[model samples]
Target: MPSLATRHEGHVLVIEMQRPLLKNALSRALQHELVSAWQELEGNDDLWIAVLHGVGGVFSVGHDVPELARGEGDEADPEPVTGLFPLELSRPVIAAVEGPCYGLGFELALACDLRIAAEGARFGFPDQHLFTSHKVASVLLPHMASLGIGLDLLFTGKTLDARRAEEVRLVNKIVPEGQALAEGVAAARDMAQRFGSAEAFQKQAIWGFPGLPLSTALNLARRM
Candidate 1:
């Protein structure tokens, strides 16, 4: 079966991680496919938004440990694999999570502009107890949550369901199980209607300009 699948609907593209047997683990091939697919979407003027998800019961089981353990991942240099970083996307992307979204899976979702999870979905940085982790929660989770909250989850490696994630503002919405992707697509469609062809440029400005001061942002906004 294909490791990943992509379909375009209206102005939105949906990419599904399709390895149910591994619970959709982020294998090297899958990562390569994701990067290529996202790059295609980034280059397309007709695509306003993209929604990412996993098939079957889980969003992902994180990186393929067996592959990494066997030295099979696409590690070309000291930098993290290109597939693991979606920060280069020039357009808005949304993550529709269900079942378990853990470790690098959680980080991938965090990379998106919006995350909409299923009511039955689970989320966590469970790799803190594992030796192979990159310790993203130590740095990124605190920025996303209260310092106390970050410590609670990170130190314990505890998982939370959809409602808890929403309460913590980790996800934008929680819908019925089996409906996360649909809900996410609906949200993306709504955003597409609101932004039209300028959606990518707008996302680039908002996410790309936050590091700049107010005057810098004003100048950037004027250019936009």
Candidate 2:
């Protein structure tokens, strides 16, 4: 079976991580599938938005350590820019998170435009314990939450439950366990039907104009 699967509910494309046995670990094969899925979504004009979720109760346990230990795949070949990561998507993508979302999993959610985490969801960056750093989380976490909160998670490798995550603005909404996917799909459909292309453009402005000078950013916004 494929590690990733994509289906459509009206205009919303639902991308599910299917590797439940491994807690939906992001292996190189899965990353390649994700890239292909994003490329398909980008090319399909009928698809308005996307929702990312995982099978089983867990969202993702992060990277496949065993696979890495075996030296099976090239970690840097495909790269994040190839749509293996969330930030590359121009269209809006919502993350429906449940169970543990750590390391690469946490970074995936951080890259999404919106996040709806279940009550039992856990978010953290445990990679620090392994003396590793998360590139996306390091830059995006502070922007999503706060400098202090971001630093705390990175330095301590501690997890925050959904409620705490919501308090820090890391989660846009928190639903009961097993309801995140439904809520996320509903939200995506709402935005797809009501907002149309405006959501995409707004996301572009929010993510793209961040590091630019005030005048340059404003100029770009005006053009958009």
Candidate 3:
């Protein structure tokens, strides 16, 4: 079966991770497919936003341990793996998370411009407790939460429930279980319609504001 799927609902592209048996693990194939989906979002004028989701009851369990343990998944990717780092796309993407979102799964959601998680969802990085991880979370966690919070999660490899994720701003909003997709899609649709004129500019400006000094950021915004 295909590892990923994409469909459009009006201007919102819905990207689904389809490897339910593996808890939607990030296989190399899936990662490549995701890049294609993002590229489609970037190139298609009719597509204004994207909503990323997982199948089954779970979001993802990060890397497919079994595949890696077997010394597989070594194929070099043409582009940077999508969820492991913040992807640069002209259009905004929202994560609709449910169940466990761990390791790269958490990082993927963090990469999104916004996240809407189901009430029973979980978030964490297990690589600290196991082998070395992709470590992209090191760059993103601090951006989303306090240094202490980021360190605590990174060092302990512990999991956070949706409520705690919300408190730490890991997720933008929490919805009833099974409603994250609806909420995410609705939010994407609203943003697409209301901000389509300058959506790309707004995304670039907001994401760029983080690491820059206030003066530099202001100048950058002026240029944008």
What count of clashes does model 1 give? Answer: 0
Q: lDDT by residue for model 2 over 33-115, one digit each (tens)?
A: 98888887888888878999998989998877777667534863323325667676668899999899988888888888899
Question: Which candidate wins on lDDT?
Answer: 2
Residue-level lDDT tens digits of model 3 in 87-188: 577678899999999877777888888899999999988666446554667888888888888998888878899999999988899999999888999998
Error of 3 at 70 (Å): 1.1
Off by over 4 Å in 1: 72-80, 133-139, 198-201, 209-224
Q: What is the TM-score of each predicted model, taking all chains together? A: 0.87, 0.91, 0.91
**Model 2 TM-score relative to the real fold:** 0.91
2 against 3, candidate with superior lDDT: 2
lDDT of 1 at 128: 62
**How would the candidate models be sorted by TM-score, starting from the highest?**
3, 2, 1
lDDT of 1 by residue, 124-215 (tens): 86766455544555555666666777777767888888888888888888889999899999998888888777354476667766447889
Candidate 2: C-alpha RMSD after superposition: 2.3
RMSD of each: 2.7, 2.3, 2.5
